[model samples]
Structures are given as structure tokens and as C-alpha cells.
Target: MSFKNDALAYHSEGRPGKIEVTLSKPCHTQQDLSYAYTPGVAEPCREIAKDPAAAAAYTAKSNLVAVITDGTAVLGLGNIGPLASKPVMEGKGVLFKRFADVDVFDLELATTDADAFIRTVEALEPTFGGINLEDIAAPDCFYIENELKKRLNIPVFHDDQHGTAVISGAALLNACEIQGKSVSDIQVVFSGAGSAAVSCARHYIRLGVTPENILMCDSKGLIYKGRADISGTYKEEFAQSTQARSLADALQGADLFAGLSTGGIVSGDMVRTMNERPIIFAMANPDPEITYEEACAAAPDCIMATGRSDYPNQVNNVLGFPFIFRGALDVGASAINEEMKVAATMALADLAKTGDVPEMVLNAYGCSSMKFGRDYIIPKPLDPRVLVEESYYVARAAVDSGVATRTIDDWDAYRRSLEDLAEGIQ
Candidate 1:
């Protein structure tokens, strides 16, 4: 499992990145060409022009999700520029196709200006069924989602924020249950105040965890009353009572340690300092704030999680994005509401608890039985129920909330629609 430059050499040597945006249908023969281009395509275009809603059926608008990024927060690299972020976005598009059956095209806006980002995304609204704003930095990310949701008629989801929230929330629900703690009775502390941190903290809050008990921390320390350093809408929206100057200061007797910051940010001491059977989610991608082994070594009673694939409980957005998007688009929904995310999280948690585990869930990190315990409280990213359960919950929530345009008379058929989407992804 050791990574080398050779893994990337072919990718660099080939045509730019991983994907090739070729035609989906054929036009090799003249008769086929007659229907596929020029005169034949004009009728649908004309119909679409006459009736804008008809574009959904006549063109690819209904199946497409736009992956827009400002190159401000490109994976772990961070602000690597539009050119550099292309690989990651292309990879994301590939994931959307391979995992969720959503056709995604990457859009890297040249400017980092918030208004420009807003205007740009708003302008492209007509082309896609949904807009997935990825890897844009916070405060700006907050603005972009808010504006796009307001302006666009389709779903505008900031995946780094909401997808991370839904998946992490699902894991934490199971983690809290394993630790014999409920959402109403826990003191949660998130390490690193990024998109993931805010989303996790907010999900906990929406799930009935008290805002006062949930302490969120950034680089300099906990984001609290006296912290004048961090001044943004995200921080201000979910300010905590714990005014500690360090991670250790915030972790004393804390029930949960959610890390969404850089690698090695949360030390072993931080995990050990928390309450008995503490739940830890060091969810920084590529590497986490702390490794799974390091956390377990420090506190045997702790339930640990990291944003990694080669380990147990890989809390990747892969578990959430596809199904979440599928549910939203299937219903022709306008926005990804928090209630839908909460329902998806709850569904995921419940799904992980049922039946025996799959080998795909086991992954490279061994241990034959993947039970709901310290090491394996959450389901793996590849767990099939992610789409099956979460999207069901989402579709139902969409209908109940009066946001969904598509209606399903039978619950089983709704479930089938979600599964069908997953089938296409594979």
C-alpha cells in the first residue's frame, strides 16, 4: 500500500487527467449522423427553446451535476490553483459516475472573488440538474451555497460541508450509541473549524445536542466568546461556550473529539484526556489529525475515525455525495435541506447496525468481523446501504418537506429508483 510517483506518471503522461468527455450516443453511419447532429438535433433544441422545462427530457440537463470549485480548498493541498485542482475535480466527476451514476462535469472558476463565484455558478444553473460546489474555502463556501441556493432552481450543495456532515453525522450517531451516549447528553469538541467541522457540529446541534455543550476549535484554540481572531459567519453562527486557548484545554472531559483539521493536529494526549469511551473522528483527508492506531493506543476506551481508505471506518464523502445527490435530483428538489441530511445520517446509522458486515467493508485493514465497537462503529464507504437507506430517507424527507417535485406512491418503488441510479454508477 505504499504510494509512489509511478501511480501518477501515466495520469500525467496521458491526456491531462483521468476522464475523457466523449459522446454518450453514436453517430458513425450517415443515417445515424442525420439523427445525431445538425438537422436532427435542431428539433429538440427548438422544443427546448419553446419550453424550458422540456430541456430536462430532450437534453442531458436532468442527469448532469456541475462540480464547481474556486481552487481555494483543493483537497489536502489547499489553494493549489485552478490548473492544479483539475485532477481532484476530474477524480470527483469520476466518482460521481462510478459510484452514484451522476454525470458530473468539473468547472473551475478563475477568480476567487465571492461575487464572481456566485454570479458564475448562477449563470451555469440552466445546464445542470444539480450544482455540487466542491473544495471552496469556508466563509466563501458559506456565501456560495447560500447565494446559489437562492438564485438557482435546482439543488446547490457544497459537498465538503453537507456531504461531510451527513457521513460524519451517521458515524457519530453510531459512535455515540456504542459509547452509551445520546445526542442530548454529550459534550462534543471539533478540532479544526473548516467545512467539515462546521457541518459536523451543526448536524450534532440539529440532532438535539446542545449548542452550549458542543465546543469547536481552530488552530489557535477553541472558537469562543473571547476569540477575536476568527471573525466569520460560520464561527459566529455556531459559537461555543468553551473558551480554552488550546486543543487540550477544550478536550478536558469532552465526550467526542471530531478532528477536521490537518494531520497530527490532535495528539494522543487529546484523545486520552477526553471522557471514558470517547468518540474521535480525526477526519482530515489523505491523513487525519491523528491515526486510528495512535488514538486507540492513547485511549483504549475511545472510538476512533479518520478520513482514510486503507483503514477501518473510512469517513469519506463517497458514502454520502452520490446517494444524497441522487435523492435530491430524483425528486427534482430545489435545495438540500438540513432535515434531509439529518434523515440521511439517521438512516445510515441504522443501516450500519443491521445484519452482518460485507468484505468490501472490511477492506485492507484486517479483522474478520467488522462489528459496531471502538474500531468499527461506522460502515465503510463502499457499504451498499449508503445509497439504499440514505436516499430513501432523503426522498421521503423531500416529499414531507414539500420540496420534492417527483412523487412516489409506493415506498418500494422509490427505493428502486435510488438503487437504479446506483446500478448506473457501477
Candidate 2:
């Protein structure tokens, strides 16, 4: 059968969905049922009621994350509604389990209203260790995450924004290193002005990319200071006081080009105008701003990456979120802060620089060679080192940044803990 039919059959054939709940403890006998429901369960319940933090110990809340979404922006599918978005959310839960052994309960909210969405998620704080905001549209997504983060003590992450930022930031660091270009010195042009674009600019700024050196372009020409239609907090934040009116104008002499916009928006002519060894991340999913073939033909000197796996350097978000949340949840972190994200990004960059590709990773990608160069600027998603190293760095950052409620005094033991988690042990 074809892919579409196969996917429909896979989800509908057996369980009717991708995820289900299984008993952690058996309840086959009368004694087990009494302990599970009436008396023994009440003991943990009363303990949790006496001390709220006891919930983390007596319940499954510590390792649980809610993959919450309103389905406003269902990736390439685009606003397919909550029911249609369930499969994707379940897929995300699968990644969380497969990568970090973190438990997930995928929650798809039917309301598209930002206030309703925020309130719904806030009410769910008791059930999950963290809230992962997914596939919500741009401005609303921003509003929801900000309000939720302030209202709830748990980590609130809009994966659409920060996930891309973290993974792309890692790729950007490696690309800059290979090209011998300093972050502060480079003129970066972004070909989109939505959540990912604005968030990336903010993240790059935190990573040492100069704000004034960056230019963001939307459907309208450049997001310049005097643009009439400019609105929203993030758009205003990235607005530049520049004379460059178009993407092509901004690309001239630019050292980096980041495309989070629609596919095929960038032409070969635009790539030709960039500075020597320019880094281009044409990260539109299923397609890119410029095709890999066209980009090579345009500027052979350019180091390029895309969102497609078929390409050499694919900037995938799977390289992030799972490990990030793993570290955050493991440390009992109050929030996923900038320091933690930077640690993850730098860890990724450092890992790639080591040029140590595991045989399993190579076999997974079906590649004979994987080294630190133009072709391999970031680590593969299946690399087990990401769980140990990235989560280790993130957990350490959380502790140092004062966001962690729990402490890890033994570094060696902490590494072992992460190793155990990666091995699917609690």
C-alpha cells in the first residue's frame, strides 16, 4: 500500500490510535485490586494531599510531560483541528519515550482561542512535569507560552519556536566554525518573520549574533523599522533600521541566510550574492527555500542545510526537545531557561567537532562516512551520545542557573543516571 493508506491503516488497524495506557502494576488478583484502588492507593493519595511535592514521589507526575496542542498549525498539514492532530501528538510522545524514556500524555485541546488554550493547559499543571506547546499558530503561540510560563511553575516550551532555534543554533555554530566566521561579524538574513524566524533571531542574539547585523524578511519585503504593517512584540523586536528593502538586497554580502519561510522562495541568484563560504539553512520542511541541488549550483562555496533527511546537513528538531526535557525533568527543573538551551546547543556543536560517529549512527543513516565537515556539521538524531552528553550539559546548566529544585552532587553518578534512562530503565 501507499504511504497515506499505510499510515491510516497503521493507526486504525489494532488499537485505533498510536498510544495507550498500560498498568504499571498488576491487578489480576483480589489483593492486588484492593491495594491498587481502595487502601494502598489511598495511602499515597493522602501523603500527596499532606505535602504537594509528595506527588512527584508517590505518583507518575515526575516523569510525565503533556504534549499539548490546539492544532492551529499542524506543521505542513496546517490547522487540521484537534482530532486530526492527535496522531502527530502521539508521534511526539513516541519520540519522548524512545529518546529519553520520558512518559507522555498527548493532550489536544479543541479550542483555538488563546485565552481558552492557556487556561486549559494551566489547569493540567498537576498532571504533567512539563508542558510542551505544539503546532499553535504564530502570535497566539507566543502569547500562550509566555502566559503559561509565568502562571505555571513547570517548564513551558513552544517546540515550534525554541526547538528549531536550539537545533539550528547548534548547526549555525558549527557552520560558523567551519567557515571561520564570527557570529558578531556576520550579516545574517532571515527569509521569514513568523515564530521560528523571530525566535531564531532572539536565540542567535543570545548565542552572540549581533541584533543589528540580522535582517528578517516576511511576505512583505524586509521587516524594516519604518514598515507600516509591523505589529506584535516579536516582529517589533526583530525590526531593523536598514535600507535593504528585499531579501535579495539583504543577502548581498551577507554571511548567513536562514530560511524558515515557504519552500522555493529563494532563487539561485540570491545565493550567488552572498559573501564567501556563506552558511545557508533552507529549513522549510518537505521542501526548502532553495533546493540542495540548486544551492550547490548557485554557490559551490556555500555551506548549506535543510529540513529534509535526504540532504547532507538536515537541521531536525528531534536532535533537541526529547533530550532537553529529559534533563529538565530529571533535575526537577522549574523552567527550561536560556542557559540550559545554550548548553544543549554548545554540547551538540562540541559533539560534532569531535568527529566520533558511532557505527550504529552511521548504519542508521546508511552513510559510509560521517565526519566534521560541510556534510556533517551536526550529530545524527539516533546517536546515543546525545542522551548522555546533551542531557548532562542541560541538567548541569539548570543546576547552575538556579532553575533546578533538585541537586546532583555527583557528576559521575548523574551521567550513569542519564545512561540508565537512555537504556529504558526508570
Candidate 3:
């Protein structure tokens, strides 16, 4: 069957959707029903009323995330709107549950008005422990996340903005190691200045990349100083005072080319102009700025990755989000701070270098031999070790960074708990 038919059938089969709400507690007897609803529920509600923080202890709020979207930019299908984006949202929830065992409520907002969307999500703060903002278009997404982070005590994460940043950042760290290059000295060129692009650029900076050495290009051209169309705070932040006016000009001798733009935009010739042993992450989904074959044919020595499973090095965000939130929510983190993000990235990069690919992961990828090198810069999505490594480091960072409300006193037991969670997922 075709993919479209398969997808439709898969979603329509059995329960008619990808997810369902099932009670965690038993309700077999009449007494159980009464305790589950009226008397027992009321006691927890009364306790939560007396102390707001008790809600985390008595309810599902501690482990719940809201996968929210206005659907202005649903994956590669841009501006599909909210009602049409339910499947995507539900699928996101599935990832959250399947990967980290975290419960999710997929929330698709009906309106695109940023103010209305922000207010609506803000009101939902009491219901969820964290917010996973998905598929909202840029600039507005930046604004909404910033405002929500300030107003809401719970962690607010824009997966489009930070998920790509964390995953790609990990890959870049490993690639730089293989190439014997320093992020501080490398000249980086970005193909798109959207939410992911700008966020990744900033993330790179946090990971020791020099700001002035980076060049970001939007649809118009290279984002340079004095550009009339520079719209938002993030655009202005990356705007460079340089002689280069286009991607081609900026890419000459560049150490990295991060493509968060459209497919097939970077030709083989463009790849050939980069520095020796260049790192090219052509990460546009479904397709890329340059195909793996095309990039390899051009710059034979270049380390490459794309947002594709078929590719050798796939920059999948699945490696980051579920675990990041898992760590945050476990520790009752107020926000996913920069330290926590960097910790997760470093954990992923470190995990790859350990050369301890689980047999299950190897089998899932249909590979007999895989290790930290040019093609295997990041862990596979099914690598259950990620649940332990990424989440552990992120939670520890939250504690050290003063964002966590709860702390893990016994490191060994905490690791065991994470391992159990991973085993359950597997």
C-alpha cells in the first residue's frame, strides 16, 4: 500500500486515532469508583487548594506535558492551520509517551492570533507540568515562548526552536571532534534564519562557537547589517557586518553549512566550495538542501547529515525532546535553561564517543558495526541508552543550575529508575 493509505489506515484502525486516555488507577468496584471520583479526588483537590505545590504530588501534573500548536507551520506542510494539524499533534504525543513514558495532551489551538494563542496556553499552565510548543511559525513562536516562560512557572519549550538546536548541536560537537576542528575557530553558514536556524546558531554559540564567525541566511539572502527587512530580535541578533551578501559568498571556505531551509537548495558545487573536511548538516525534513550523495560527490571529505532516517547521520529531534522533558519534569524544573540544554547535548555527544552501541540499537538500525565517526555522529532514536544518559545529565544540570524544585539524592538509584523506564520503552 502507498504511504498515504498506510497512514490513514494506521490512524483509523482500532481506536480511530493514535492515542487514548486510560485511567491509571483501577475502578472495578463501586467503592473504587467512588474513591476515584468523588471522595478521594476531592481530598486531593482540597489539599492542592491549601498548597498549590501539592498538586504535583497528588495529581498527574508532574508527569504531564501539553503538546501545543497553532499549526501555522505544520512540518514541511506550511500554514496548514490548527484543526488540520490534529494528527501531527497526536503523533507528537505518541512520541512523548513511547520514548520517555511521559503522558501528553495534544492541544491544537483554534486561532492563529498570537495574543489569543498565548493567553489560551497560559491558562492551561495548571494542567500540565511543561509545555511542548510545536509547529508554530517563527518570530511569533519566539515571542510566545519568551512571554510564556516569564509568566508561567512550568517549563516552556518550543521543540522547533530548541529540539533541533540540541540534536544538531550534539551532532556538530561529534563532527568537529572527527574533523579535528574547533567550534570557536570555524566559520558557520546557515541556509535559513527561521526559528530552528536562529536557535541552533545561538546554541552553537553556547557550545563555544564564535558569534562573528557565523553567517545566517533567510529567504531574501544573507542576513547582514543594514538589511531593511530584518524583522525580529533573533534576526537582528545574527545580522552580520560583513562583505558577503549571499549564501554562496558566505559559504566560501566556511567550516559548517547548516541547512534548515528548503530541499535541494544547496547544489554539489556549493558543497565543493567549503573548507576541507567541512561539516554539512542539510537537515531540511523529508528532503534536504543537498542529498547525501550530492554532498559526498562534491566534497568527498566532508562530514554530512540530513533530517532523514535513510541517511547515515540523521539529525532527528526525537533524540532530544522526550528525554529533555523527562529530565525536567522528573526534577520539577521551572524551565529548560541553557545549562540543561548544553548538558543534554554534551551527554549525547559523549554517549556516541563511548562506542557502546547497544545490541538492540544496532539491530533496530540494521547495522552490524556502528560507532562514533563521520557517519555515526549522533545516537539512533531507538537507542534506549539515551533515556538514561540524556535525561540524567539534563536533570543534574537543572539541579546545579537552580531550576529544579526536587533533587535526586541517590545517583545510583536514579540511574536504575531511568534504566527501568528505558527497558519499559524497549
Question: Which pairs clash inside model 1?
Answer: none
Q: What is the TM-score of each candidate against the true structure?
A: 0.93, 0.97, 0.98
Top candidate by TM-score: 3
Which residue runs does candidate 2 get wrong by more than 4 Å? 231-233, 424-426
**Per-residue alpha-carbon lDDT of model 2 for 316-398, expressed as tens digits?**
88899999999998888889999999999999989998857888888899988798999989988888888999999999999
Clashing pairs in 3: none
- lDDT by candidate, in order shown: 0.81, 0.90, 0.93
Question: TM-score ranking from best to worst?
Answer: 3, 2, 1
State model 1's lDDT.
0.81
Question: Which ten contiguous residues of candidate 1 have the minimum total lDDT?
Answer: 358-367
- Name the better of 2 and 3 by lDDT: 3
Please report the TM-score between candidate 3 and the true structure: 0.98
Model 2 worst lDDT window (10 residues): 417-426
Mark the regions of model 1 whose C-alpha exceeds 4 Å error after superposition: 13-16, 231-233, 241-243, 359-367, 420-426
Displacement of residue 417 (Cα, Å) in model 3 is: 0.3
